[model samples]
Target: MASPASQDIKSIGIWIRVSTEDQVRGESPEHHEQRARAYAELKGWHVAEVYRLDAVSGKSVMAHPIAKRMLTDIRTGAITGLVFSKLARLARNTKELLEFAEVFRACNADMISLAESIDTSTPAGRLFFTMIAAMAQWEREEIADRVKASIPIRAKLGKPIGGAAPYGYRWRDKKLEVDTEAAPVRVLAYELFAEHQRKKTVARILNERGYRTRNGASFSDGAVGRMIEDPTAKGLYRANYTTVGESGAGWQLKPEDEWIWTPVEPIVSEELWERCNGLLAARATGRRPAKKTSYLFAGFAVCECGAKMYVPARRGKYVCAACLNKIPVDDLETLYRSELADFLLSPEEMSAHHAAANEMLREKELLIDAAESELKKIVGSENELFDLYHAGALNKVDFGRRHKPLSERRAQIEDELPRLEAERDVLKIGMLSRDEVLEDAKDLSDKWPDLPWEHRRQIVETITDRIVIGKEGVEIILLQVPFGNDDELATKPLGPRFRGDERY
Candidate 1:
């Protein structure tokens, strides 16, 4: 039963979207469009236009050109009823789905999903749409988490986990197989890089010698550097090498130990890889690359004014271009390591924190049990009311009056149950292993001078958000990642990480 306005709207727009070409046997774009058309015909509505977003991933709504055009048309009220084969085809995420709903509602357009029989013209249908959209997003995130979790499992079993096969290898029969043509190029690239101690020189040599990458592209210095530095080139798998970055900063590199490593069929010997990397490291510090003084934290460090820190050739001073903030490289590294050393909780503090977590967990469990008991009591009351109504103990109006509040309370508790259960899991807190932090921090703080600049950089990158060089002093923001909350870890200390010598 449509509204008079909706029934009078004869022209309906059909939207068909599929993420990949590998759709189910009868789930092609044509099949979906046909279904929408059939549904429109049954409603006695004419087809306005078929909007097909073929082979478009629903991950991003704005990425597809047709989707943008469709939304623009929606905003302009060009279409009456906007119809889709399925909700997932409309959008993958809840926020995007809600935005679509808002746009449609604003344009006074109805949205119809044929597969789910959801018509936004009805209140219940709108509610169902929101719930389904949220459920779909949660399911997607859970599936992605499971997939990401399986990466280390795959690596442990010595399997390649969905990255491009290294330059010298190709995936064959679900394994890394040495590429005959490209293997020699990888070998030669390393040999040249080791001898020449430069990626540009190796790139030129490889190109001049008619050697190219697996993609048949001429070797660029960056490409050559990547090939030489990659552990995958020497037949090793790397997992968990990335960590969540600061807001708006993308993923950052983690410590080497955080990265899971497994062996693969060796393309080059470990000795050769070591020699090449060692030579590469020697060049990183000892030699000036492209007439620029390469600071250990060049790209990794930022200033208070939010500009990148760079080292000038003359004075070994790390200067911020925007604010002219300066700090000596040695002093900056020392202050950073000192701040990091203080990150680990003491033995007594950690013990107390663990105790608090256990108590909190127990309290949460009891609270959930109490909530569930109350919910069950309400259910029992509702059943009693229904029984009375059936037995002529109450009139229909009275029955409705008694049932509404009970139903709302039941719905509220039912909705809250999942969140409460999730909180319980989140509260299943683990003790921060001070020893783990101590070993790494101690090594970085006390033993860094003996280590190479490359090793030092790798260690520094593991926990540093960025070194903000303020006029007051250098501010070091360490990546804490507090066990229960992420925001708790984002704090900066009251004072400078440490002060440095006066600017030259």
Candidate 2:
């Protein structure tokens, strides 16, 4: 150098920051601050003050109040130099760091980072700052890339991410759960929409009832409409989409058919859910689009002559396409109900089979109870170990070695719990078979003739399957397990029976 730099030129201020409370408890920020003070003292510089910002992110300069004051001091000539632990500690955002560097230049002040050996007073130091800024930008981009790549992978696995949980859900243990508090609001919204079929009316009802969002804000019509359409109320998750444009961002609703169904506990019965969808569709299309005719049995109905029985008209008229043999729609309806009743219950040996199914369910309940008890024992052991470590009875190394295996066991138990619970739900559902099948059978009998041909086809498909029309007669297949396997219920047909070549 032409001359040695003046040792007592100006006062230097130390800038120290700890990003989180955990980091504050650790030796990081304090150690960096100590090293920075030592470095300043070794250079024979006067230390003006040390400004510490705790739990502040480096991404935004505006968030740190103490850092802002230090910038003011440097600009007013109260400090000629600012020292920090590293470039990242100074600022992680490139634009803000460069902007502050310009301000430092204007005040004739110096910037020093002890860890990075960066001194912005010299040309070489300024080049190093530029390189640091470029690296910070690269780091940020890499982080964003990782996040983008992980989103779809997590979503497909039924993991919750991105925005807040839908109206009826709460985020718990990194998953979405039914929020007891908000569930009633969701039910009310659906009920209102079902009754009025008007978004404005639903919003008015909610607001009048003092129903508000999580933050206590009053509901808008658009908000109420969204709540009605969200699949989470039916225990499914749907991804919403957005597009960037000149106006800013545009959002669009995805159709229900395109949504992903993540099987959680159903809050509404399938029948009720279907009814609501039918009502919504009716309102949307202005007129009821003739009901969907593709039943579970539509394609499966084959004549004895190896031809399909096609329902070609609006009445319950079905004919064998190949042989031209026809049967009244009411007759086919009766044959299907009779077949289902027979499949569900054999009147000859009812008590034996009913006892068997009940016994099977009781055994399943016992297995579920045993599994749950085992899970509790494993959880209890983990809690004890955690308490020991907290009370200083165990060291970190010992706690970690024991805790890792316990956590693995607990995870296995958690995985098995859902399957066990599902089995229990199914058994409970099976116990209510009589009322369900009889009610459905009676309802179909009453509505069959009155319903349009297309609606009749839909109802038949909803409950029955595999109708084979033959030279001998028509054969009907029930879709699910018949409700009365214990008795010969099929012999007593619920509706009108069909004979060969019968006409309505």
What C-alpha RMSD separates each model from the true structure?
A: 21.8, 31.4
lDDT string, candidate 1, 109-159, tens digits: 568775565665433345555664566446545645665678688889997
**Candidate closest to the true structure, highest lDDT:** 1
Q: Identify the candidate with maximal TM-score.
A: 1
Predicted candidate 2 versus true structure: per-residue lDDT over 330-359, tens digit per residue:
566567755555544454424443565466
lDDT of all predictions, in order shown?
A: 0.62, 0.59
Over 4 Å off, model 1: 1-190, 193-294, 298-300, 312-315, 342-435, 439-444, 452-455, 481-497, 500-504
